[model samples]
Target: MSSRLALPPWLRVAAAMFAVGWGANQFAAMLLVYRDEDGFSSEAVTGLFGAYALGLIPALLVFGPISDRVGRRRVMRPVLVLSIAATVVLVVGGHSLAVLLVGRLMAGVASGAAFAPGSAWIKELSADRPGGTGARRAALALSAGFGSGPLVAGAVAQWLPAPTLLPYVPHLVLMALVVPIAWHAPEPAAPAADTSRHGHEVWRVLRGRPFVLGILLTAPWVFGAASTSFATIPTFVDVDVAPVAVTGALCGLTLWTGAFVQPFGKRLGDARLIIAAGLLAATCGLLLGVVVARTDLAWLLPLVAVLLGTAYGLVLVGGLTAIELMAHRDDLATLNAVFYSLTYIGFAAPLLSTLALRAVSPTALMAIGAAVALLTIPAALASRVSPRR
Candidate 1:
């Protein structure tokens, strides 16, 4: 909101750090495949995989506001270093699923710490721009980083020697690069006006009406959209809907559409409108997926993938932007953490859908997911599109 918050070179460096940590997104996707390859039980894999969200949610809640007191760089630097540490652990301990889980938990903590404040910082730094360029750039960096993780990891897994080892190896290299940059990154001075607030205030903030509505309208989109690409697309390939390469392509499309297309979504001037449009698009995609899957129309899968992918990108960007606009500037990190918590709730959809697929047709599973998306549309539209207070 202040001119002092204008973008600077150091902000870009911080954004890079934020983006690089998203390699875990790619790792999350590949982990399921890896579990099957390594002969881990589905239950065991699910437990191990869910650790990221478990660690992330609490860290996000605890650390989000801490940055306001201690300073953004203070929180981010250590988290980035920890992320580097987790990458090392990932490579050194790949053979042990237990160690892998710990590394993921560590990575989750680092990401949760960095993501909240980092997003807030981005918006703050970009506050001087005419349009909400800072918000848009922050959204792109976050989405791109998450999106690119799969492409980079998937490519390495597909082509390089030592499929397991190669994917993480690149992350280690990126972490090395992120350290020096994070060290020198500039931050807005911590709120000079410090009021020593006690416990439960954070929870009170989370429980506010708009924030609660934000969670309800946003969660299903997060779960449904992420699962469409990560959970269901691969299954579609297995059922002969399309080739495996298409999965990667669709994943890329989903993320890229979210990252690049979001600038336009911002122009719509209402987060609720953008989210509603995205939900409707995603619903169509999911329903079409059901149709194609049930009818055995393999070629239709890619088209459906495109629809879901684009819709996901739009919803992700709009949802986050809405969160940013909805909260106080100083509260950005906490709000972001809360927003990500909802997203990770959706992130869990894949696991639930995995269990559901055992009992229902994959088509039915996707159709149900589509129905969930449809349900969100009306709620998003009905929600007031007020800018962040």
Candidate 2:
């Protein structure tokens, strides 16, 4: 079969997004290796975990516009180089903080560059598939990438000779496989005028009830819930399996389950119940975390992963679909960038919860998260009444 026929156009673009996502998240399960084997302090560990966002936010803001003006193919083609560079640095850096940070930052840049363009590209390619097919495709690609990294890395790190170095190899191989597709993915430049009104345009859209009540209120918790499941919960509870392996399994399960649920989320959104359902699931997941934290119940961790995973998938797809329904054609990348930037805010949840654990009990801190999730459901549901014209 021809390469084009073997891999559908949309799936080709999705490959780039997946590879970047794998680079971005492979670090999550390895946090254990960094702490236990590398002898880093808690603050430094948090720094390593949180470093991606510093590079990511600016990339999402800047590269999305560049892609819009130039074309997705132009912008996305170079990110794989950065992704490979990041992994190589990670392999060579060993225990050096500066090297690790640089590696993560490079991965963040690749992900940021890939996400906006990839999201826009896949959606355009999938235009004929179905209403929410694009959103589901994007989410599934990203979630699968995110899940696979930690899953493979955790297992490799547990059994392999060099825990840190060997785990990143598979991602390099994955990226190489997707290079042809990313380079040739079909997105012709639309050539809209770049204007000075970007900040204003972002604010205008952010101010709208549809975004404020619907997406803004719910989007952050997508990552927030996922991070809580794999990152926060594992910190407090003891699992009987191999340490890094268990952590990686939880991380993988959470995101993989999220990936599988994208279609279900799309269905809920089409029924007009997605926002409420997604937020409610997040709230309940947090509440369940509180219970698990209080009881130290390792057995329930998988359940926690499932619930939050479902929430993550639902909120992610819902937010994307919401943007698709509301944004103008020219505004798609910018709006997606904005929505994505918001979601990364939730990436801070695990760090924040860790810092807070010094003073507040884990259960109490998690209850607060549940409360926050509960508060957003109504706002998100109400926002559906008004969409940008």
Candidate 3:
């Protein structure tokens, strides 16, 4: 590998963002292990899954504006440290449910603190790059990290020894090295101005029809559909059709597709159209999820991944692009944070799916989700009519 010093500032920041995202989703594959080994109930596992959002949302609301006031580096450095701490907590605590909860909360805080600032830093560092390139790079880094975490964890947990301990060890090592690299990454000379506004300002911006509707129609479904496709659907599949390793790979496939497709979203040249198309893809994919679950055609999981991944890519990039166009430079981080905060709602999909299963069959639940996705199309289409700020 090349020396850390030789890597560009944008790459370093991207690496840090990648680490944050990886940490956020690393536990997805581990949920099954906990259930089997520790005798955890399905509800307990669901709680653990949702715990990341518990820590992430508040952190984003608070740290985003702080990063806007202070430079990005100052905010990112401590969050990177917190990320390392979270991994250590996970490694040391082993299968203890309380410890895992705390570790996940810390992981959420680190991700929330890092993502918006790190993304804003990438944009500033790549100031000379073409339009939407920075956002594309940021999304790719995050998707790769998020997708790979579960894949690596599942593979190691299944084939390798020390299921819990070993999976996090590599992340610990990577984060430790990334700390210094992230510390050295360059910051913009001047931070954004008007950083002292109250929370009302953020709310005021959210009131905009374009920003609110764009997020409403796209952001939550991106991860919600992903959770359905990757996390929930795999668990229910027959072991013969979807082995443990194969499940992880499918999760990775979904995310990697999202990461790779983002650049083409830039090429598509219309954020509104991308959002509309993404919602349509998601609707079809959710309906297919019902079919995949009912028919036991695990072979079709890849097709499901493609649909969900394409939705993830187009909606995420298009939504971010729309938000960027509407936000003031001074409020960019806060706006990004706000957008992401809503996005985290999708992370609750696994938990919600679990509960919904009590009342309705998986097929019925997926059909309902597909209907919800379909209903959002009008909002996505409406986004085009509003002029970009």
Per-residue lDDT tens digits for candidate 2, residues 1-389, read 26755788888888889988998999988888988888987667777877888888789988987876777888887888888998999999868989999998888888888898789888888878877678779989999999999999999999998997898899989988888767776674455654666557667777887888888778788788888899888777887679889988999999999899887776565523676777788888888888898899888888999989988888888888888777665667888888898888888887788889999998899898889888877787677633445
Of the two candidates 1 and 2, the one with more favorable lDDT, higher being better, is 2
Judged by lDDT, which candidate is best? 2
**Poorest stretch of ten by lDDT in candidate 2:** 266-275
Which lDDT value does model 2 have at 23?
Answer: 87
- Compose the digit string of candidate 3's lDDT tens values, residues 1-389: 35878998899999999988888888877877788778999888878888899999899888987888887888998998899899889888777999989999999999999888877788778778876667777888889998988888878878888887888877777787777777788876874386466456667767777776777657998788777777787655676632656767878888888888888887778788878888888999988889987998877788898899888878888877776666666677888888788888898998988988999998898899989999999888776534334
* Model 3's TM-score against the true structure: 0.95
Query: Pairing residues by index, what is the TM-score of model 2?
Result: 0.95
User: For each candidate, what TM-score against the reference?
Assistant: 0.87, 0.95, 0.95
Clashing pairs in 1: 223-346, 258-313, 325-388
Candidate 2 residue 205 Cα shift, in angstroms, is 2.1
Model 3 clash pairs are: none
Could you give me the TM-score of model 1 versus the true structure? Answer: 0.87
Cα-based lDDT for every prediction: 0.67, 0.83, 0.81
Model 2: residue 90 alpha-carbon error in angstroms: 0.9
